[model samples]
Target chain A: MSDSDAQNLREVRAIIARHKLGDLIFLVTGLLVLMIAVLTFIALFSHMLIDGLPRLSWDFFTSFPSRRPGSAGILSAWVGTTLVMIVTAAAAVPLGVGAGIYLEEYAPKNILTEIIEINVTNLAGVPSIIYGLLALSLFVHQLGFGQSILSAGLALALLILPIVIVATREAIRAIPVTIREGAYALGATKWQTVSDHLLPYSAAGILTGIIIGLARAIGETAPIITIGALTFIAFLPPSPFKEEFPYISFEWLMAPFTVMPIQMFNWVSRPEEAFQVNAAAAGLVLVIMTLTMNALAIYLRYRMRKNLKW
Target chain B: MQFPVTARRSDNTPDSSTLGYNYRRHLSERFIEAMLFLTAFVSVAITLAIVVMLVTESLSFFKHVSLWEFLTDTQWTPLFDNAHYGILPLVSGTVVSSAVALLVAIPMGTITAIYLSEFAPFTVREMAKPFLELLGGVPTVVYGYFALLFVTPLLQKIFPELPGFSLLSAGLVMGIMIIPYVSSMAEDAMRAVPMHLREGSYAMGATRFQTAVRVVMPGAFSGIAAAYILGISRAVGETMVVAIAAGMQPNLTWNPMEPAATITAYIVQVSLGDLPHGSIGYQTIFAAGLTLLLITLVFNIIGHLLRKRFREVY
Candidate 1:
């Protein structure tokens, strides 16, 4: 070959090599970034496990919180979390589902509908603590619920309302338009169509949304704190059931309560080394609860997406 | 020839039973619709309630403390005997910590998104998706514990003088917590870039990396910007990690190494302390909360507008 031609060939190879090197560098960098996120997860979990595993036991689940770290357990915290979740679910589901149904099915494309849509989006972006302020003013003071389980539940219900509404709308929107038309052709009323076809079809997605919302609510501490959840509660709310004429009582709704995250926060803020261990234990439990809920929601979503042919 | 459908039905429905049944059905349907509308309106009610609550309480606060002092004062000592009401210290702490967190999250999250969307195999993507979800799913309180008890000590080893409650550790952990949010959203945006665009890039002999950085990144720029804005909102609104790991003292400083209270942590501190209702101390939290809400709202609006404006129909 001529010298000029050989030189051109060499320069072409050099350019290709340079591009290939850039690609390789980016590949390594991307892997490192991914690893950093994954490793943080592993590290956070293992750190809690190492510090907290020994603290998890039967006594730990049975006893109430105490000033002494050794005997302090999460009994009150767990019970409160459960009861608050019950109230939150009871309050949020009906309202959120109704709203979702209305927006997706009944509402026309109008200015009012647009306003409602924008409001839901903005509500979702509002900080959790602001919800606490709202609850403190509207529920605790005006509604006279005080710093009770009912108030906390109502606060969280409001906090997660947007999530449920969005999830329900997305799930409803996923159903083919033909289904709605088919129902209408059968002379089914709007409520009847929604009750029979739309809800049944979208039940799984709605449940996933509720579970995820509840999971988020359970971990929320600032709002609960702002609404004044007692940091050290030694007893559970009055029993939800009664032996009297009425087999069920709602008095527990008015009783004060504390939850898991607050319990962890309380312990973590302590200066003692022993409290830190308890905090880690509580942290482990909280993490497990949230992660399990999230995992279940994700699994349900995946299965729903896979199974639903439409 | 001009008879309407409703008039025809009315003329044909002669039986009393049919008329009664239709009337009952109409009444019930109307009732149900009203109920549904009311439920839908509850969300709007909530927004209104939040705005009213914050503004009224903050108005009460401003009555006690001038808006000028609240805006420009550097010290935030509502509970102290001297009782300065400046919000700048908290603002400074919030800005510095969020800046630190964004520094860590944006680059890492963008890189992770690009890798997952453009480079990772299907199996790797599947594994990473759940892993990232779990990472994000961990409660902020647990993150606070990790930051305080684990990360802070580890950092102290690097810088022996690093305080046990430095903003650096909390910000780092908060960034880690936010990575999932950024990466997932950005990945969705990049993946939404039409396949033909990538094909065109490859037709010109561009490598996968080049295609992602050049063609896809620009295509998804608005979406990525939205994702970053979301990360900023989350970092700014985050409470528990800073409350537990960063000191509650509202020091007006920009150094991330020094401990200071963010807006969120200050609210938590005040909430934990017992201040009677209607007290200036109590009202201070509302003012702080209003500030926090306004900051997040601005970012959220920008993000929403960006997503709306640049959403590719293709």
Candidate 2:
């Protein structure tokens, strides 16, 4: 009787084992898929480091692009990149934050606000090249800004405006509903509550969004390219100061510019293998800048989440 | 008159208005609210301006090339010595690359999502997500650089027949670029599945893997589909990687090994070239851009609708 029972259990075990095989296969496949992504990224990063390390020198950072690969530096490129970023951040942050505050607080729950919400969502996903088209027509020709840093910055601001708005909204939403109600109870105006209480409370989160959005703006190449950012720029933008009493100058904004990504694009498009090495170095710098920005944003978000109990 | 009367009537309230504080505060508040509203309206204006800009330019372009001919034309060589305005070449190229990307991204991303949502330990999931997002944060131009400088060489070793610049590399790398997008969105959806449902599945003797695939995945299908479609739209609009790795020549062929030009790539090419502002050559790009925008807008709307539908259900 005992032997028969053992045999029946063995048969049941075999049946269960067959079903378990699918689970193992599925688990392994999932791990393998994730591994593929991790490995490809590793390979890409390491390859850039290897190719670019030799080219990273003081001269490389200080000088401008040259005809020879050995002499070409990213001075103009980095400066232009920074300037464009400054412009984009300046343009996008306040407007996006204001829009976000209005959408979340002041606007009534209605169809027109709904349309604005949808438009922002839709704009966030629009092919960046389309923004370039808009800029080319509206900014470059219609307004006659031409292919300048201001135009490129304005274009990127549009491209990233949706991102900033979404991030700001998410950040402000994380603040408790009770907080807003408390402001209302205090007889504070809506704007006062937002500017004094909400903005200060969500400042870190808003900064995080602005940083991430700027990080995204810095990495973008497509829209700027469409607006005719050059590959061969060797001069700095006009100085922002003058010999006159009024030192500040706005003319630099109108000057032609080429950002790091555009510079990389320019070099990488060359037929020469040497230029590819040049591209790698520029790519490395851009990657480092972008990654640091993202890491800072992530750290800010993590800290904000962890430290806040309510 | 009403403001001063109300200010004086409320004896319990502080008489700040007598010192001009209330008046100043009221004015500033109104000004700021209006300012914020105006800022919000700017975004709406930007959208309207985009539509206006594209349509007006496209209308002028259509005067030269009929809409039917532009749509039905089989070649797209506006820069060539003999011009052709057919958009099929660029459209096919975009479709092929996007298709290849989706085919690679969907299974890979979904599996990773399932594992992260249902199987991975907390530490592993936490560490993995940021790194995956970092991949997404990497610029498309960098992806393009990788595709041109590294991936093409790697693929050439395997296929031996693959071109230096082909849709194969761009599409595959673009898939990798989109993995975080798909996995993160899908994982969010799967995680949103009520824990009770998983407990119910477990009580019925279903394994975690079985429950994930059979129970949670179906419940999250709308979000997953939305994510997949959004990824497709991204791949379609992607410019740098395709423009860098895919060739400039417009080929309508479906073969990945062969070179093709995407709509974004065509726009890049034309803009990089010198053309007069008002000429047909310049106008041609706007028309192409209009087409690209419409195509992406359709997918985006569908994805949005699906997400809204999914949100309602939850």
Candidate maximizing DockQ: 1
Q: B1-314, model 1: which lDDT tens digit per residue? A: 01111212455557887677767887898899999999999999999888889999999999999999999999999998999999999999999889888999998999999999999989999999888987887889999998998899999999999998888999998898899999999999999999999999999999888999999998998889888988999999999999999989999999999999999999999889888989999999999999999999899888888878877667
The collision pairs in model 1 are: none
Instruction: Residues B188-212, candidate 2: write the lDDT tens digits.
Output: 9899889988999999888888899
Query: What 10-residue stretch in candidate 2 chain B is worst by lDDT?
Result: B1-10
Give the per-residue lDDT digits (tens) of candidate 2, residues A36-113. Answer: 999998998999999999999999999999999989999999989888887898899989999999888777788988
Cα deviation at B240, candidate 2, in Å, is 0.4
Q: Candidates' lDDT values, in order?
A: 0.91, 0.88
All models, DockQ values? 0.67, 0.65
How many pairs of residues collide in model 2? 0
Best by lDDT: 1
